[model samples]
Structure formats: structure tokens, C-alpha cells
Target: MLRVVRIAGPATLVGVGFAALLVALAIGGGAAPQLLEDPGAVVRFGLPTSTMLVNLAASGMIGALGLVLFAIPPASAAYGRALDVAAGSAAVFTVAAAFTGFFSYLSVTARALSFDDTFSQGLGQFLTQIALGQAWLQTTLIGAVVTVLCFAVRNQTALFFVGLLAVASLIPMAQQGHAAGTTGHDAAITALGLHLIFAAAWLGGLAVIALISRQIETPKLVDIVTRYSSVALICFIVVAASGYVSAELRIGSLDRLLTPYGLLVLVKVGALIALGVFGALHRRFVIKKLGDTGRRRHFWWLIVAELAFMGIASGFAAALARTATPVPETVPATQTAAEILTGSPLPPELTTANFLTQWNFDLIWILVCGFGIVFYLMGVLRLRRRGDRWPWYRTVLWIAGLLMLFYVTNGGLNVYEKYLFSMHMFGHMTLSMAVPLLLVPAGPVTLALRAIRKRDDGTRGMREWILLAVHSRAATVIANPIVAGVLFATSLVAFYYTPLFRWATEDHIGHEWMIVHFLIVGYLFVQALIGIDPVPYKLPYPFRLLLLLATMAFHAFFGLALMSGTGLLLADWFGATGRDWGVSAIEDQQAGGGIAWSIGEIPTFILALVVAIQWSRSDKKETKRRDRNADRTGEAELGEYNAMLEKLAARDGR
Candidate 1:
């Protein structure tokens, strides 16, 4: 029965996906022949089909690798087989990507196919120069690299990085989607990216399980399925959220639901709902019965059904990419200065009320904040249930910090940061200082270590990974007070003075990277000072105080320099925002400097107070230790000291 599932699952997935894609394309006019620049029926139809294959193959590669990294033991036969699956899938991804690229070029140019220098040159230029062509080229190349790495690398840690590379291969595809230049472009891109990544993880993981079920014992298979189910649950939530955002952007209104694009979206939504139900059944019913051989066949058959639904979702998703959106994704005819510079219209004037009330949510940070809070609470609850005492203050602080992070990322700061230098600085300061201040004291690492179970079955679990990271040499180096302080202090200059500032401002990916970089830097620095989590090395209280003071001084100096500067940072971006209201670009930059110097220093001062309190507590504890020792030892050390003093005095008298 398992063998039959192994064969039929993938066949069912491909067959169903192809069928759905054809039906969707037919209904949506996605594959219709162009009247003016028809690339022929072959290119018109083949592009979506090949792109669909690319999605399928990429999913298979990423899903298998994820299972291997997080669930399967490296030494197991299933691990190697999963890698083989990834490699094979990657190979297919490479070929399919290349074909999609070719079809895309033919469709765009509508040029006749010929074996001539001109045609070859045009193809070369397209792949190298054009953004769309470059995206496909990058995808194909990355797929090829992933394929080779899967075959060659066996170490679990190395494979994790390879998995990251595989996931990154989807970013270009996300960029090429319908929302690239539209309103809410960043939100759309983020949603689509998350959708692709999590959807692949969900669909491909089950396929891997089905293929490898017969190779493993029933007990182990049950464990693997349980783990995969957890991942699939996360995928389901993210896919649903991202799908809604994508649909909202593309359809624009509920009334448009009858359009071909929206109808395809509905089909995908139905498929997602069906897949979610299958996941629920597996967790609630089928997994427990897997121990009984009599019920094993039912599990495999259910997997077949789930794969069929996943196929429908995948196919509609691909077709929807090519389908025309109900709302046109075009810029306004009369672009404002804000729209010209930031690709968005000027928001209302920056007022105190608007500052607090406005919002522009980022899906990525929204998920991060949600997951961070939930997992931390889960860990805390687990500790409590085990009769361990976890601090309520820590939980409060953790939740508060994540909420602040969410606000900084998704609220008013995000809305105006693109148009105003001051707003960007304000958000940056909050991210690097205030949020980390709250989070570092929460001791998330310690909570995770205590809550997650230790695995000794030659498989690395969350506990093992956490311990490995904390004890690693890199952690030791970075956790050093001097190093963390230097990174925290000097990064401001390095980032703002270099092209990094411009990149982080203009590009969504770069913007996200900026947030992560500063947040981590601040976390490491604060953790080095007052964090409850264990570090490889720590300075004495006095030195910690000294380090904090020095770092903040340097930080203040950076702000002063910015204030005194006659020039503006990213002059083109901040200066060119054709706004008739608010401060001039240079004045705004100076105000940003003032914010960095003043508001940013508030958290540092809090750190100083905490360190001082810790110092006083340390002295009190030392005194108590000595008093106890004297009590236990009958004051023998004191008597000895007195006798030595008397002997020295007698010798001086003689």
C-alpha cells in the first residue's frame, strides 16, 4: 500500500496540477494567442506550463531539504534518499526555469525562431540586460547550483545553508509577479514571497513523506509525519494570510470576484481549504492510528487526496500569475513628488495625530511578531506545566517588545520612512535600542533551552541547535562585550556613510535586511551587558558599565556629526521627495540626527541604571557570602589576620 502511494502520489500531483492549470488558463484567457505579437500558440501555452513545473520542482527540492534538516537524522538512509529527491527536483527546476525563460523571451519579443547571430545576440542581451530575463537566468543558475550542492554535501549544517539558497531562488520569481510596480508593491511582493516559500514547504514535505514512508519503520514514520504536520500548519496559516493580501491587491474589491483572475483565486482558496482539512485530519485522527498496520493504508490514501488538492492550488497559482488582474496595476497619470520618488503618493502632512493613527503593515514583520509572541508563550506554558517557575515579568516584557517591534515595522514609521529621513531615523532608533532593551532582559534563549525537549536519538532538535549556537566559537566572539559594543557603535557610521544606506532605503529586501541587522546588533550588544541568557564570557560589572558608557558616547558622537553635517544622506532619496510641506531635506536630516542623539540615548541610560543596580546587588551578595563563611568557620580567618598584625607590630617594637 505504501509503495502504491509512493508511485501514485507524485503522479497524481503532476496530473492534477496540469489539468487545473489548463482549465484555469482557458477560463482566464491567460494562454490566449496575442493578436499583434503572438509568439505562436506553442510559446503562449508552454510558458505557464513550464513555469508551473518550475514551481513544482522547486517545492520538491525545498521541502525534502527542510525535512532532512529539521526532522530526519543525518545518518539515516531516509536522509540520503531525501537529498537525492532534492537533487533530482533541482535538476528539473533548472531545466524548467531555462525553458520558462526562453518561452518568456519569445512571448515578449514575438520574434521568429531562427539560428542566426542576430537572434542569438538578442537572446544573450535579454538574459543579461533585461530585468525579467535576468530574473529567470538567476533562477536557473541558482537551481543548478542547488542541484550540485544537494548531491555533494551530506553535513546537516551545510545542507541548511543550501536550503536557504534554494529558498532565495524564489525571490526573483516573486519580483516578476504582477505587483512589481503597482501600488502596495512592497506588500504584494512580501505576501507573494511568503506564499511561494510556505506553500512549497507544505506541498513538498508531504510528497517526501509519502515517497519515504515505505523505507522507514512505522514508529519513525509517525514521528516524521508529526514533525511535518507542525511545519504544514505554519505553512497553512502563512499561505492563507499571504493569499488574502495578494488577492486583495489584485482584485481590489469583492465585486470583482466574478472575474477570471478572481475565480482562479477562489479555486486556489478552495484547494487551500481542502488541504487544511486534510492536515487537521492527519493530526487529529490518522497519525495516532499509524501504529496499527490495519490503518496504515488509509493514511497513504489520505495523503493521495491531500496531494491532489495541493495540485489544484499549485496549478491555479501559476495560471493566476499570468492572468490579468481585475484592477490595473499602473501608476497615476499625474504622479506626485512622493510618488515619483517613492513610488507612492504623498501621505497627509506629518501631524501628531497622523503619526499615532496611520498604519502600513508589513506581512513579514507581522508574522514575525505573531510567531515570536506565540512561541515564547508556549515555552512559558510548557515550563509552568512541568512545575517550573517562569517569570511573569519576562513574559510581559517579551510580548511588549514584540508588539513595539510590530508597530515600528508596520505602523506610521513604516508609512513615512520612505518619504522622510526623520521618520526613518526614528524607526531605526526604536528598532536598535528600545525593542532590544525589552527583549534582551526577557531571556528568550534560556526559556527555549529549558522548554524544548532534549533529543538523544542522534537527531538534532531545537534544544540541541540552541545549545550548539550558544556554545559555538562565533557566538563566543560576538558575545564578547568589547566586540558587541564596537559593532553596535560603529555600525551606524558604516551603514549611513556607505551605499548601504541608499540600498536599504530604496529596495524592499535591503530594507528588511537593515531591520534585521540593527535588531540583531542591538540584541547582541544589550545581551552582552544585561541579558539573562548565558554567554561564553562576561565582563565584571565595572567593565560592563564602562563599555556601555563608551559605546553610547560613540553613538552620541555619531549623532552630533550627523547634526553638524551640511550634506544630506541619500540626498537623492530624501531630498527629492517633491513635498511642499515639512522641513527641507537637510533640516530633516539634522532633525534625524537630533532624534538619534536624544531618543536613542534614553535606552542606553536605562541600561546604565540596570547595570548600576546589578553592581550594588553584586556587592551585597559578596558581603553576605563572607558573613556566612565567617559564621561557619568560627571567625578563624579574622583571628589569623589579627595575629599577623600583632606579630608585625611586635617586630617593629623590637
Candidate 2:
């Protein structure tokens, strides 16, 4: 059975994956009529086929590395084998992505490649200059880098960065899916990006397990299966949720499932369901008996089936990319400037009611908020079950903070942010300041530390990871009092004054980076000051208060500079939005400055007050500890001090 699994498992996976791709292409109309008439059968069918290969290879490369990082012990032979697989797979991805990019050009423009200088110049321009072509090029370059790193690098922690680079290679894939100027463009990018990443993790992890089955002994197999199962569960939920969002955006309605694109989607979904069922069965029954040869046979059979299903899912996905969505991914040729810039119709007049009513569900943020609330509640429950009391106030504060962040990201602030500078600033303040204020006092790290059971089996669990992060050299530097203060103060100015403001405003990837940056910088500053989470050190109250005031002054000066300045930041974005409902763009800029100048101070004041309260409480706790010690020993240390002083005086008198 072991020999059969070893020879057939990988072969079955590759064969099935390619076979499924061919079938989905036929179903999804890889033969469909094109807007252009010049490109022939090879370019049409070959483009998606190559793309399927890219996806396949990328999953194998990324999933193998990630599993090694997260589940397998770094010192094992399995780890080195995983890296070898990643290196081999990434090399394949590099080649495939380069071809895929060239094919994309052929498909989109219906042009044949030539070796002329004109053709060479155009190809270079497309690769380096055009968004769609640039994405594939980036993917190729990233894959090449991963290929080399997988072979060259062996350090475990450094490999985590390699894993991250592998994950980021998909960002361009997500971006090119929905071209710029499409309605729901940001949401589509977010959804598809997440879908690609988690799907790869899920698909690749299983493939790695099949690849490594022969090398793993029974005891290690049991442990590996259990750990990978947990990762698989997380991947399942994310893939399911992101798939739904992408489907809803593209499919639009259940009736549309009858269409070619929808039919391809259904094929993918069916495969996903089968995969989920197989995974559940493996976890529920098969994994418990890995040591038994009979159950091991069953497990390998399940692995084969799971790999086939993954192939189906991956193949259908590639085909779907080539298929036209029921609704075109891009808007019609005619569009308002606002639509072109912001990817949606100019928002209706900004009203108080509209702020609360408007929504742009950034899927990444929704997942963040959702996971945060769920995990927090779980921690609270864990504490409660053990007859331990966690402060209700802390939970409320945490929820409130996350909800505030949700509203700022998805609510009215987000709705108007792209159109009005004032709204953008308002949302920024909430995310960077108000939200952190509410959340910092919640002491999330403390709760996680107490609630999560420690793992002593040499497996780094979530709690251990959190602890390592808190005390890591990187965290130590970032969380330093001066560094945190400087980052908190300077990020606002640096972002606006630099190209970052333009990038964040226009690109989904940059927008997400902005959100994370603001939140972390805010959290770090608060963490340094009033944060109850364990840190290397918290400053004395006086020093903390001084730091707060100094940053406040810097923030005020920045806001004042904005208010007093005659210039507008990101003139092309804010200045060109062509809004009619709001005060002119210049006035909106001034309003943003006012919000920054005033609203930021409110959060600073709150930080100061929290610091003062914590300081007073610290004094009270110290005094109580001293009095309790005195009572315990009848003030023996104080009496000893008094006797020593008297002995000194007596010696002087003699």
C-alpha cells in the first residue's frame, strides 16, 4: 500500500489537475468568440492552460514552505524535503508565469509575438509598465526569488519571510482579475486575493502531506496529521468565505448559475465540498488510527481523493478566469472621473444619515474583525469555565474598539473617504487613535496568555507565538518609547507628504497596508504608554505623560501645517475627484486638517487620563503590598532599621 501510494499519489494529483483544467476550459467556453478576430485557437486555449500551471506550481511552492514553517518541526528531514519541493515548484511557477504574462498580452491584444525592436520595446513596456502585464511579471520575479531562497536559505525564522514573499506573489494575480475603474473593484481584489492565498495553503498542504507520506513514521504521522488538520480547518473556513464573496460578486444571482461562467463556478464548488467532506472524515476517523496499517491505507486513499478534488477546484478556477463574468468586471467605456479614480459612481451627497448607511465590505477587514471577536469570546469563555473571572469591562472595551474600527473601515467614513479629504482624515483618526484607545486597555495579550493552554510538545502554538512576538528583537525596537512616539507622530506626515497617500488612496493593496500601519503604530504608542500587555518596560508615569504631550504637540503642529498650508496633498486623487456635493476639494482639505488638529487631541487626552489613573492605582497597590508585608512579619525590617541607627549613635557617644 505504501509503495502504491508513493508512486500513484503525486501522479494522480498532477494528472487529475490537468485533466480537470481541460474539462473546465471546454465547459467555460475556452472556444468562445472573442472581441478580437486575429488570435487563433492556441493562444486562446493555451493562455488559460498556462495560467493553470502557474496556479498549480505556486500552490505547491507556497503550501510546501508554509506547512514546513507552521506544522513540521524545522529540524526534521521533512522540512528540508519541503524546501526542496518549494524550490522545484517555484522554478516551475517562474517559467509558467512568464509564459502566462506573454499569453495574456496575446489574448488581450490579439497580436503575435515578434523579435523586432518595436516588439521588444512593446514587450518590455508591457512587462514593466502596464498593470495587467506588470502583475504577471511581478509574479514571475517573486517566484524566481522564492525559487532561489528555497534552495539557498535554511534558517527557520528567515524562511517565514520566504513564506510571506510566496504569499505576496498572489497579490498581482488578484489585482489583474478586476481591472481598474470597475465597480466593486476593491472588494473584488480583496476577496480574490484572500481566496487565492488560502486556497493555495489548503491545496498545497495536502499535496505536501501526500509527497511526504513515505518518509514519515507512524508516530510523527499522527502528530503531523493533527497539526495539519488544524491548519486545514482554518484554510477551509477562509476559502469557503472568500469563495462566497467572489462568487456573489461575479455570479450576482443563483439563476446565473446556468451560464457558462456560473457552471464552471458550480464545478469548483462541488469539488470544494467533496474536499471538505474528505478532510472531515480523515480528521474524525482516519487520523485516530494512523499507527494501524489498515487505517493508514484508508488515509492514503482519502489523500488520493482529496488531491483529485483539489485538482478539480484549481482547474476550474483557471478556466473561470478565462471565462467572462455575467457582469463584466470593468465598467462601460464612459465613466465619471470619480468613477475612474474611485471605481464607483460619485457617492450621493454626504449626509449624516448616509455616513451610517453606506457600506463597502472590505473582506479582509471583515475577516479580521470577525476572527478577533470570535477568538476574544473564546478566551473569555475559557476563563469562565474554569471559575476564573475576567473583567467584563475589558471585553466590552475590546468589542467597542473592533466595532469602531469596523464602522470606520466599512461605514460612512469609508464611504466618503475616497471622495472627501475630510472624511478620509476622520476615518484615519478613528483607526489610528480612537480605536486603539479603546482596545489597548482591553489587555488582549494578557487574556490570551492566561486562557490558552501551553504546549510543551515542541510545537509552537498561538500563545507561544504571541509571547515570542512580544519579546522579539524586532518588537523590542518598534515598541521602544522614542521609536513608538516618533512613528506615531511621523507616519501621518510622511504618508500624506509622500507618494504613499496617492498609492493608499488608489490601490487596494496600499489601502490595506495603510490600515494595518495606522492600527499598529497606534497600538504601539498606546502599548508603550498605558498598555497593560507585558512589554520590555513601561515608562514611569512622568515619562509616559511627557511622551504623550510631546507627541501631541507634534501632531498639533502637523495638523496646523495642513490647515495653514495653501497646498493640497495628492492633488491628482483628491483634487481630481470632481465632487459636486461637498465643499470644494480645497475646503474639504481644510476640514480634514481641522479634524486632525482637533480629533487627534481627544484621543491623546484620553491616553493621558488613562496613564494618570494607572499610575495612581500602581501607587495604591504598592502601598497595600507594603502594609500586608508589615502585618505578616510585625514590622521586623522597620525595627531592624531603627536598631541599626541607634547602634550607630551609641558607638559615636562611646
Candidate 3:
């Protein structure tokens, strides 16, 4: 029965997915013949089909690697089989991406097929010169690289890097499709990107289990399934959240639910909800029953049922991409200066009320902050249940840090940062200084090292990976007090003086990278000074104080330079926002500099004070240790010292 399922399960998924895509295309007119300049029915139908294949292939590659890295033991036969599955999937992905790219060119150019140089030349230009073409081309090349690496690399650590590359291949695809040129283009891209990655991980994992089921015993299978269930739970949450954001952007209103495109979204949503319900059942009941010989067959059949729903969701998703949105995603007939520059209209005036109330939620940060808080609480709960004490204040501090980060990334600061330099600087200050001050002392890494169960199955789980990263050679260098301090202080000058500041302001990906860069550097520097987490080296308290003071001075210098400068940074962006209200552009820039100098120093003061307290406590502890030693030794060291003094005095008398 298991063998039959191993073969029939994936077949059912592909069949169901293909069927759903056809039905959705028919209903939404996604594959309909164009009124003019049609790329032929072949290109129209073939493009969606091939694109769906690309998605399925991508799922298999990522899912298998995820299981190998976290779930399956390296010595097990199933692990190698899973890698084989990933390799095979990558090959399929490569071919499918190539076809998708070619079909895309045909659709766009509406050019007839030919055997001449003109045809070859146009196709080459499309692949090399055009944005859509370049995206697909990059996908194909990445797929090819991943394919080779999966076959050649067997080390668990190496495969982790390969998995990252596989995931990155999806970025270009996420940026295009329904996300490009949308009103909330950045949000849409972030939403769609999260949706694709998590959905692939969820669906692809189950498929991998089916493919490698024969290599595992029931006992081991139960463990793997349990681990997979945890991952799927996370994937489900992210997928649902991102899907909501994507659907909201495309549909715009509840009334649009009756439209064809909206109905297709509803279909996909239903399928996802059903999959989620099935996963819950597995976690609650079926997983436990799988260890029973009599119930094992029944459990595998349920797996097949879950895969069918996944297929339905996947199919409808691909079709929806090709379908037109109910709300037009195009630019307006007339544009405001704010719209022209930031791709959105100028927000309401920046009153205290508006600043506190207005929000532009970044989907990525929302997930990051949400998961961070939940997982930290869970770790604390685990420690308490085990009769191990974790500080309540640490929990509070961690939660506070995440909340501040959430506000900086998703609140009013995010909304106006593109238009106003002061807002951007305010956010940068909070991200680099305030957030780290709260987060570093929380000792999240210490908690995780204590709370998470140690896995000895030759497979690296989250705890193991965290440990490896902490002790890695690269980590040793960068986490050094001096290096971290230098990076923390110099980044301010380097970023603003270079092209990075402009890139961060103008590009969505760049902006996200900028936030991450600042946050990481700040955390490292603070950790070097007063962090509770384990590190390779720590300076004495006095040097730590000196380092903090030095960094503080450098930060002030940078801020002063900006304040005194006649020229504005990214004048094109800040100066061009065309705001008639609030401060002028140069004044706003100066205010930002003032923020950097003054508001950013608040965290430095807190850090220095904390260091002093720790230093005083260390001295008291050392003194207590000496007192205890004196009592243990009964003044023998004092007697030896007196005898030496007596011998010296007798020699002087002679």
C-alpha cells in the first residue's frame, strides 16, 4: 500500500494541479485568444503550463533540501534519495524556466517563428536586454547551478548554502508577474515573494516525503513527519498572511470578490484553508496513529489527500498570475510629484497624531517581528516547564525590542522616510541604536542554546545551526570588539558618503538590505560591549567603556558634518518630493543630522551605564571569592610572608 502511494501520490498532485489550472484559465479568460497581435494559441496555452511546471520543480528542489538540512539524518538512505530528488527537480526547473522565458518573448513580441538570423537575433536581445527576459534567464542559470551543486555537494553545511541560492532564484520571479507596476509595488513584491517561498516549502516537503518513503522505517518516519509538521505550521502561517496581503492589493475591495479574478483567488484561498485543516489533523491525531501498524496505511492515504489540495492551490495560483486584477495596477492618468518619485501620493501632514497613527505595514518585517516574539516566548515557556529559570525581564526586553523594530519598519517612519530625510534618520537611529540596546541584553541566543533540544542524528536543526554560526571562523573575526566597533562607527560615514544611501532610498530590496545591515552591525557592537550572548572574546569593562565613547564621538562627528554641509544627500529624492508643507529639504536634512547626533546618543548612555554596573558587580564578586579562599587556607600564605621577612631581618643584623 505504501509503495502504491509513493507512486500515485505525486501523480495525483500533478493531475489535480493541471486540471485546476485549465478550469481557472477558462473561467478567468487568462488563456483567451487576443483581439490583435496574438502570439498564437500555442504560446498562450504553453506559457502558463510551463510556468506551472517551473513552480512545481522549484518546490521539489527547495522542499527536499529543507528536509535534508533539518529533518533527515545524514547517514540515512533517505537523505541521499532526497538530494537526488532535489537534483532531478533542479534539472526540470532549468528546462521549464527556459521554455517559460521563450514563450514570454513570443507573447510579448508577437513575432512569427523563423529559422533566420533575424529571429535568433531578436531572441538573444530579449534574453539579454529586456527585464522580464533577464529575470527568466537568471532563473534558468540559477536552476542549472543548483542542479550541479545538489549532485556534487554532499556535506550538510554546504547544502545549506545551496538551499539559499535555490531560494534566491525566486526573487526575480516575485518582483515581476502581478507585482510589477502595482500601486503598492514594494508591498506587493514583498507579499508575493513570501508567498512563493513558503508555499513551495510547504507543498514540496510533503512531496519529498512521498518520494523517499520507502527508505524509512515507521519509527524514523514518525520523527521526520513530526519535524516536517513544525516547519509546515510556520509555512502555513506565512503563506496565509502573505496571501491576504496579495489578495487585498489585487482585489482592492470586498465587493470585487464576485469578479472572475477575485473568484479565482477565493478558490486558491479555500484550497489553502483545507490544506491547513488537514495539517492540523495530522498534528493532532494522524501523526500519533502512524506508529500503529494497523493505522499506517490509513495515514499515508491522508497524505495523498493533503497533496491533492496542495495541487489545487498551486494550480489556481499560477492561473491567477495570468488573470487580470479587478483593480487596474497601472499608473494614474495624472501624477503628483510624490507619486512620480515614491510611486504613491503624498501622505497627510506630519502632525504628532498623524505620525503616531499613520502606518505603512511592511509584510516582511511584520512576519519577522511576529515570529521573533512568538518563538522567544515559546523558548521561555520551555525553560520554565523544565524547572529552569529564565529571567522575566529578558522576555520583556526582547518583546520591547521587537515592538520598536516593528514600529520603525511599519509605522509612520516607514511611510514618510522616502519623502522626508528626518523621518529616515529617525528610523535609522532607532534601528541601529535603540533596538539593539534592548535586544542584546535579552540574551536570545543564550536562551535558545539552553531551551532547544539537542539533536544527535547527524542532521543540523535550528539550535545546531545557531551554535555552528556562533563558533564559525568568520563570526570570530567580525564579532571582535574592535572590528564590530569599527564597523558600527564607520558605516555611518561610508553609507551616506557612498551610493548605498541613494540605493536604499530608491529601491525596495535595497531598503530592506539597509535595515538589516544597520540592525546587525548595531547588535554586534552592543554585544561586544554589554551583551549576554556568548562570544569568542570580550574586552575588559574599562576598554568596553572606551570603545563606546570612541564610537559615540565618531557618530557625533558624522552628524555634525552633515549638519554643517551646504549640500544635501540624495537631493534628487528628498528635494524632489515636492512637499509644500513642513520643513524645507535642506532644513529637513539638517534636522536628520541633529537626530543622528542627539536622539541616537540616548542608547549609548544606557549602554555605558549598564557597563559600569556590570563592572561594579564583577569587583564585588571577585572580593567575595578572595574572602572565601582566605577562610579555606587558614592564613598559611600570611605565615609564609612573615617567615620571609624574618630571614631578611636576620641577614641585615649579621
lDDT, candidate 3, 1-654, per-residue tens: 678887888998999999999999998888999999999999989989999999999999999999999999999999999999999999999999999999999999999889899999999999999999999999999999999999999998899999999999899899886857647989998998999899999999999999998898888899899999999999999999999999999999999999999999999889988998999999998988886653578778988999999989888888898898998987788888888888888999899999999999999999999999999999999999999999899999999999999999999999889888989999998999999999999999999999999987777889999999999999999999999999999999889989998888888889999999999999999999999899999999999999999999999988898788779888888999879899899998999889999997889889999999999999999989878877899867777899999999999999
Q: Which scores greater on lDDT, model 1 or model 3?
A: 3
Pairs that clash in candidate 1: none
- Residue pairs with colliding backbones in model 2 are none
Residue pairs with backbone atoms closer than 3 Å in model 3 (clashes):
none
The best candidate by lDDT is: 3
1 or 2, which is superior by lDDT? 1
Q: What is the lDDT of candidate 3?
A: 0.92
Candidate 2 lDDT tens digits, 549-636: 9998988888888788788788888888778777878888988889999999898888889899999999999999989999999998
Off by over 4 Å in 2: 32-35, 113-118, 291-294, 643-654
The candidate, 1 or 2, that scores higher on TM-score is 1
In model 3, where is the ten-residue run with the lowest total lDDT?
291-300
Worst 10 residues of 2 by lDDT: 289-298
Q: What's model 1's lDDT at 641? A: 99
The TM-scores of all predictions, comma-separated, are 0.97, 0.95, 0.97
- Relative to the true structure, candidate 2 reaches a TM of 0.95
lDDT of each: 0.91, 0.86, 0.92
